[model samples]
Target: MDWNSFWEGSKDLSTFALAIRAIILYIALIIATRLMGHRQVGILSGHNYLVAAGIVSLAAIRMLNPESSLTSGIVIVFVYAFVNIFLSYLDIKWPKTIDRKPTILMKDGIIHRKNMLDCHVTIDNLLGQLRLKGAHNLSEIDTIVLEPYGKISVIKKPEALPLTRKQMNLPPKMVALPTILIYDGKIDEKNLHAIGLDHEWLMTKLREKGIANPKDIFLAMLESDGTVYISI
Candidate 1:
């Protein structure tokens, strides 16, 4: 082929390669974001928003830059991955710096108008999100927290009931949140300590439930009523 024809052919090949690279980069970013966690997409906080925006911007540049090589796109992907890992480490080591703390936007059923304004959230939007979460009335909401990730959490006050003993079908019992004793065939030591238990205590409890080993119990619960429920 003549030099002119050869050059033209190479340009066409580069275009095709760039198109493929763009598609791959786009899909990889989506997968990476998903793997990072669901919160990465739902909560657009400081670093999270930047990371998401940067990915889209870089992908566009890769597709548009005809001279951009495959290695350049790969480098961008690695850069994003490293940033995510570093941020996660910071979040673990110093939670206060990395994770956005929840702010009280509403207290005692009264809305903090200044806070709402600062967050760029209106009463209508707040009520809409709350209603979606099954909160029908503002009076029912005890506290509304504006999460760092631009999400609002509504906590409702305990419902009032008649003061008749006959109406109370069950005794006043405090229900403890269920703890994961074993996950993926491995014991969670942190959870054990949280529940004030040790390996020996768990083994003994397992034996009473006819579970030969901790692995035999898929899920176990220790209730405030001093009851142990085991699921295999």
Candidate 2:
């Protein structure tokens, strides 16, 4: 039904059917969540994500028409919110009974291809996640675990955890984040200007590096130490 029918039509008739629909759908959803077990109880997990989409869609569908059911849509939406809260509580109370444990994606610096495939995680996803977790060197990583909520936990090798400046009793140098001047062959004029550098200065640096065009550089960063790091 269209939206015009929802607000303009007989509110009494729509409300009657909507109440029945909401009650039935709500009960059925609760039952489905229970039968599905831990799979659907995950906080923001795939199942929960799908459930949210489906429930929201159903509530929206009931809202578009039948003036009587218009108010039912609001009730259904709030009901779903409470259901999600209930599922979250169940997940916490029972733990594994309603959620799977974190999966090991890699161990001993070796990627578990089979486990990765089973977990539906691709190598690109693994490496990208690892990089975000500061595991730049796979060889220096002891283990990589894929958390249930999609966190990538990394265990670095012993040698990788070298003595820090604090341990050595040495003064730490000021940390300066490198300004990205170019990325994917495109120049970032705003960042360049923010760093007090202009297009001419960038061109000069590129010329010194034997690069005739900024488009040839895939990534270019201007360091605080007056150095330009380029990756083509």
Candidate 3:
């Protein structure tokens, strides 16, 4: 068996064979990803990210290019996936073994310049993340922690805390999270059931609001305060 010719089989395989090979590799890739349990793309840790990249590369190579040992390619993909899963388990049990400790970028309104430098977080990045957390002035912050995932958690100073109803001795009103009843002209039956509303009742309410059909509304949300908002 010529080692070079082994990988050169892609040129000789017919389109029908290529199609079958593509299907098998595609299924193998999907299964491997499912086993890894890493759903959100591009937000993975360094190890998991590498595993994902490797699996994709393997699938692409065997599916489009030379169909190397199809069985071996699939086994390699699953092996990488299992290794990733094991790493995640280890991280859960032994934390810093897989995840770096979160660094404090700011404390008591003072930015930790040295820690920021060590963590490779720039002054501009600090300010940007702060702005995203609704904080503009460093002096108004209590502590800002930078997570391993490149996200920041901001804590405002006690003095800068917003005044709530409790602070003013005002009566606290019950709050209910608004649920989407319809989105993009499609009714969410599950959400409607969770909200204790039926289809007939929704249709009746829509008609009362001069909407004959729920599909005519672009978005419809039900608030806890018995308010049904319809966006056309």
Candidate 4:
């Protein structure tokens, strides 16, 4: 294979220079995300998500357009992050300044039609979200809360809840979580060590399952019952 030509790009800049630029921008983006706060990273609230979207768009522009100023991109990122933090501080100090309290969509199995209308939520939408939460009908619900993040939170009535084993005086059995031994053809040595197992034991188990190498197995999980489950 002609590896050099495969990796070759426009003659505008040397590959070494491109690599350096990529590394710097990568680190800068990480710092920018960290400054944006942990909550805003993966699980963003309503307004925070908008800020995150804008930052992502700006970062993309800076990455694709080589003529764009890197310093300007970094400045915009930090500015957005700090502005979001400042607004959050104000929200805490004056709760009503930015965030609205959760809206009640239903009360005691009765749909609050006016409240739902105010929130622009349809009955079908409410029913779909309710079904997602395992509620078959409105009679089984006590309260339906519309969270600010555009998700519905349902509270089932205590009387309508399904019976549990404890209510019938059943004994509890020991439950142990399954540990991942291998994932995506790579053995997770740290997890194996944590579960008091080693490479030799894993290899033996794999051999027993007709897998000569750990890489041949797609996934391997150690169950609580001392069984190694292999998936290829």
Top lDDT model: 3
lDDT of 2 by residue, 51-159 (tens): 6686758755664444445445555555666666576678779867776678988788788899899989998898899878777888899888887778788988888
TM-score of each candidate structure, all chains considered together = 0.57, 0.50, 0.77, 0.73
Better of 1 and 4 by lDDT: 4
RMSD of each: 9.2, 11.5, 4.1, 6.2
Candidate 4 lDDT by residue in tens digits, 1-232: 3233223323365556556555666787788778767767754366688788888898777666655666666777888888888877776797666877789998887888899999999988888988888887788889999987778888899998888889989987657999999998999989999978888999899989889978887899999888899999
Query: In terms of TM-score, which candidate is strongest?
Result: 3
CA shift at 145, candidate 4, in angstroms? Answer: 0.6
Question: What is the per-residue lDDT of model 1 for residues 37-126, given as tens digits with 9 covering 90 to 100?
Answer: 764676445787887788778767666765555455667766786787678668769877888777788998899999888878887889
Cα-based lDDT for every prediction: 0.72, 0.74, 0.81, 0.79
lDDT of 3 by residue, 83-131 (tens): 8888888878987888688899887778888998999889888899889
Q: Rank the candidates by TM-score, best first.
A: 3, 4, 1, 2
Off by over 4 Å in 4: 1-27, 64-67, 89-96, 173-176, 183-189, 196-215, 223-227
> Using alpha carbons, what is the TM-score of model 4?
0.73
Decide which is better by TM-score, 2 or 4. 4
Error of 4 at 56 (Å): 2.3
Stretches off by above 4 angstroms in model 3 are 1-9, 38-44, 67-69, 171-193, 198-200, 215-219, 223-226
lDDT of 2 at 47: 41
Which prediction has more favorable lDDT, 1 or 3?
A: 3
Which scores better on TM-score, 1 or 2? Answer: 1
